[model samples]
Target: MEESFMPKVSVIIPVFNVESYLAECLDSVIGQSFYDMEIICIDDCSTDNSLNILMAYAHRDSRVIILRNDCNRGLAFTRNVGLERASGDYILFVDSDDYIVKDLVGITINEIDSVDMVCFNYKKKDEIWNSGDEHIFKMKRGIYEAQEFFVDTVNNNSVVHSAWSKLYKREFLMQEDIRFITGILYEDIVFHFLCMMKAHKISCIPEQLYLYRVRNDSIMTKRVESKNITDYFRIACFIGQFYLEHSFDTRLEKAIEQYIQTVYHSFICNYRRYELANHGYILKEAIAEKRFAKIFGIVSGIENYYGRVQKKIEENIGLIKDGNSILVYGAGDIAKEVIETLNYYDVILEGVAVSDKSGNRKSLFGNKVREITEYLYKRDESLVILAVTYKFYPEIKLKLSELGFNHYLEIF
Candidate 1:
């Protein structure tokens, strides 16, 4: 590849402490069926062997470009560096720990010529290239207007916020000055919305190309601490301001309202009671703002529903015997809430049950995390609590029933 020769796609990967999974991610990128692609890996002063692994690949392939940061910059800043150095016609960001299918580049390139951006589907897994569970793009495959695409993404809860699993036109991003918000937790939210709003035409393909690794240590899935919740509320405020500044239509306003409501629900359900009480005033002030006053009712309703659920659980607490240990299924935010709620009732929480064993093995709430199968064998008689989202409740319930575990309950 010559200096003037531009590739079809520039794959930007921000490398940090991902030495354990960098090689597999690079291998998938280098092995893409599409040859006219540049792999840009920005080493963010990683304190691991990630740089060495990237160097080895760069030595082997001329298309691989490795950039280094002088100091330890966060993901958003590192990604901006990649965007500045990118020379391709299209841009695609891939986390260092995640990989994509072989045909990802080829398929994206085929469809991207007709639209400003191309959206695809992804699968979540614990290991690289594990085809265990996949989430396909549910929208029809065709070009859509910018607003239509935005509304569809919000409604479907699909590819609205994630920077990955989508191919972006470099020129479009540059022209609109769309870049990730540096030093923020949910930086992708603003960038994603800006790109979608600026894009005149977008295309959706129902192909599961990217494999998202659900590591408990990842920034998005890590334990819900005070800063995480605060960052979420900050992002919610930013979204509200963005909508008001643009003066979007009522339909889009409603979509954003729903998005805010969902975030509030998750925040109330995940954060500890004391933490919420300490930080609840910030949310109240944000909602009281003139721009955000419309969603106050939605937020209050979410809190009311949470209270109702807590009352229901309190009313049914007598059903469980004193000796019965509680096992929480799912190790995400919802599970943390379930554990906290049960502790409020003086229930004995045994441990957390995760679907994948290869993920973060760290203990939560001082209880060791175990795979569902291992947990069942260890304490089959414990009262199992399905601490997952509402959409996943039925499927998880069916799974538990098939495994001969009748002592299960769902907190929705």
Candidate 2:
């Protein structure tokens, strides 16, 4: 097909009250090098200037099509509305607040070929970041068995939770009658989970391209109404139940257990959400009936296990106390984990190396933070702990070698 005659890709964005960043989000899509596409901006009855801003953009760009929710329909219903009106070969849902990479549309479509879904990496940011590599969340990619892509997403990666992060073949979704549930808070997740399960082929690339803005108020991450919390539990159970109803893959079961471990670890013991009691009761029932015993076996006492690991890392700091200095390789969660544990164990935290991403040279946990280069020049006998995510291990190790950082170790 000629460029102008090519089927337009419908980029669906569900709008709410994101006045501050709506223009940036729209600019990225409008400026996309890909010309044969339409922007479907759904105004979900915002109480702010969001709808007006979207209208302004629509007036400026003929390709921008605007839709309105009769009332404040949830994200799922908004997306379903976009899906219903999308007259394109492919459809993609992007959050009203988040913006895509500059080459996101072109690169994804080029690499997508004829796959049912094109998955790309996304980076989370409390502030805007130009380099996508600093805060990336990676997931498994490849062809999946012909189940609804949404079905596999529940235990692995909730597709609904990430509607804006991937591209969809619109025909595949509409032909399968995949639509989001109305009057629900987490409709995207439920609908996406249902959609992906029926997908035949999926592709993933590791390029960290999507920027997810974490608003300071964190309202998006905050707890919803009591009724919404109850709805969440029902949705959670329905997701797990759907996965169990489908197949006999032991690998899938093991993966499911890991997700449960993470959930129980966060909601049950750690974050200490008031949700603990109700969920804890269900957990106890599961243990009593031995229903998800395998999950329990894998996750039981994970807290204590982490505590022991922290203890061991502190013990390793014995070297630093014995006439050796220490360098911590990461400045984020894991580095903080090790630094805090060492201080708890009475090991003095001498120097902290913020990850090379920013080449930061300031205190993150305490007044001890400095650049790795600065730390190296300041001290000779320092042993560094490669306290970073496992995925970054190889590159960080190589970076260390280039910088002559030989005296280091990893927990794994």
Candidate 3:
């Protein structure tokens, strides 16, 4: 490939310290069915052998371009660097730890006709590829006009904020000035939201083109630190501010409200995760600011949900003291309230059961937090409280049933 030669698509891969999976990731892209593309791998000062692997690939293939950062810049900056060097008409992001199907580029390029962006589905991979069963981005092939994309996505709560799952037109992104925000953990949320808001023609494909490797070290899989909570609040404030600056059509009002409601639920549910005393004050200040009116409107109703959750928790107090090992099935806000209410009646909580211990606290309410699967042998002896959101009820119920857990209290 010559300097003057331009590719049809640019695959921007921001590499950090992923040495073990780099070759597989690179191989998947290099062996893509589509040939007219450039693989831009920006090494973010990886301390491991990732750079050597990247160098080997770059030596073998002319299309595999390698760029290195002076320091260990984060994923957002590394991606922006790749964006600056990308010489393709279209763009696609790929994480160094993940890989895509052979026809990913070919199929997405075929569907990208006259559209600003093309989003496809992805399957989750751990030890083996598992059915993610996620509702996000699970949609039929269709094109959406200007605010229609955002409205539909938010209405269905199907916001796949990962940049890796989409193919974007370089011209549209540059015209809209859509770039990743630096120094943010959830940069994709802001970038994807901007694209959804500005894009005139966005297409959704039902094909599962990408393989998302679920690792314990991944940012989203790590424990919910104070920074994570603050970053989430920052994203909410940013979305609210963006809404204030741009006058969206009235048709999107309900959709935007629904989106805010979802974010608010998480914010309130993770309130106990904030470490600093001023964290509540930060939210209060955001509420006071008119720019965050959309966000804080739901924030105003935070206490209302508590009453209902508390009432539900109290109703299950009698069954808790029936001589079985008591455990809470969730570690969220409602779980905290359940524990507190149970403690009010001097009920002893044996443990807390979580889907995964990676993203949750090691201990909740002074009880050791373990995976729900760990209690399969003790299912008969444990009395569990399913304290989770309404949206997750069906999935949790099914999981409990599958694990042979019969005695459990359900909280909406």
Candidate 4:
């Protein structure tokens, strides 16, 4: 490509107290083989030494621009600063704590055709910065069109409403007035949908080339309040109306229909302990108004109409005896729920077992956390509560039986 023929991309990064991983993040953005882009770092009045480090970088390279916020505005506002100051044909958001693969820019840039956004698979990293992931995807027709991208991605299990993992056209983004929601968490969820709705052509590339670092201090991973759900649901409900008014398409509608359930369920599950005074009212309104789908998520995944069946099983499990010594079958959030419900009934949990081909095995519940393979062989045992959904039942049952387990049962 000739000098001016190459499309200019403005890579925007928002930083706030990500001092520990900022260096690595900067390296990736600055090290991009495609040098036509500018790396703009917006510091959201970080109290940490993040600004100092960014300034140090600015001194070294003219391409690295550092913008300081007058005060501690939230992520939405900081990202908008990046958006407002961006000077390229396309805009890309990279989180300060996350780093891109060496080939990420080179590959994503090739996808600048008939696409609103181009996305690649991402790897999860721990606070220590170690990477973790199973399967990654690469898809096309995920590039420019918003609603098409959302529908296809959700159906194929690849859509994640995160900003750090995608590239977007500046004109499309600006035209949509799609800025991150100020002060509120879960901005990506709503914003992504809106963008997709406004997109013309879409595409995707399935490559696990981005590293997403999981930090305890990050707002998303923190224990959320009941109001968090209220806020998220409210935005999602509005977006649903936005879609309806636009009259997008069946695929996008189906995608949102299934998605609303998971969103509501997440709200309910995250705030399971404290009753959201208006949780029921908000969800009922969302559902009754035909704003969202009834989510019946199976304990593990948001898939295959399993959420409904899982809800039915959960209703019955609540009626079971609490005094029973429970050995929960799964080690996920839902399994945690079974454990919690059992504890609510004053039942003693014996152990937890997890079976997944693509995950690291670690103890979650206080019960002697072990793999089903390891836990079932123990001669002295209690109820092996199959806390997992029916989909995984065959695999779990086969594994437990192979270990000569006879007391295996379901929480319901």
The global C-alpha lDDT for each of the candidates, from Candidate 1 onward, is 0.76, 0.65, 0.79, 0.69
Cα distance off (Å), candidate 2, residue 227: 5.8
Instruction: Write the residue-wise lDDT of candidate 1 on 323-351 in tens digits.
Output: 36677888755565666677767777777
- In TM-score terms, candidate 1 sits at 0.76
lDDT of 3 by residue, 1-412 (tens): 6877779999999999999899999999999999999999999999999999999999999999999999998999999999999889999999999999999999988888889999998876653223242323535688878478777767655678899989999999889889999987888988887887889888889878899887767766666666676676777777777766767567786676566555555565456433356667755654566656654564453454645566676676677788478879887667877786676578887788998877565555456679999878788888888878889888888988888887878776
RMSD in order of candidates:
6.6, 7.7, 7.2, 6.0
Candidate 2 lDDT tens digits, 34-62: 88888989998989899889889888887
TM-score of predicted structure 3: 0.76
Candidate 2's clash total is: 13
Once fitted onto the true fold, the runs of candidate 3 whose alpha carbons sit more than 4 angstroms away are 127-137, 274-281, 298-408
Q: Candidate 2: which stretches are off by over 4 Å?
A: 1-7, 128-133, 137-161, 181-196, 223-232, 270-412
Candidates 2 and 4 compared: the better one by TM-score is 4
For model 4, the superposed segments whose C-alpha errors exceed 4 Å read 1-7, 128-131, 135-148, 276-387, 391-399, 409-412
Candidate 2 TM-score, true structure as reference: 0.65
TM-score of each: 0.76, 0.65, 0.76, 0.76
The lDDT of model 1 is 0.76
By lDDT: ranked, best first: 3, 1, 4, 2
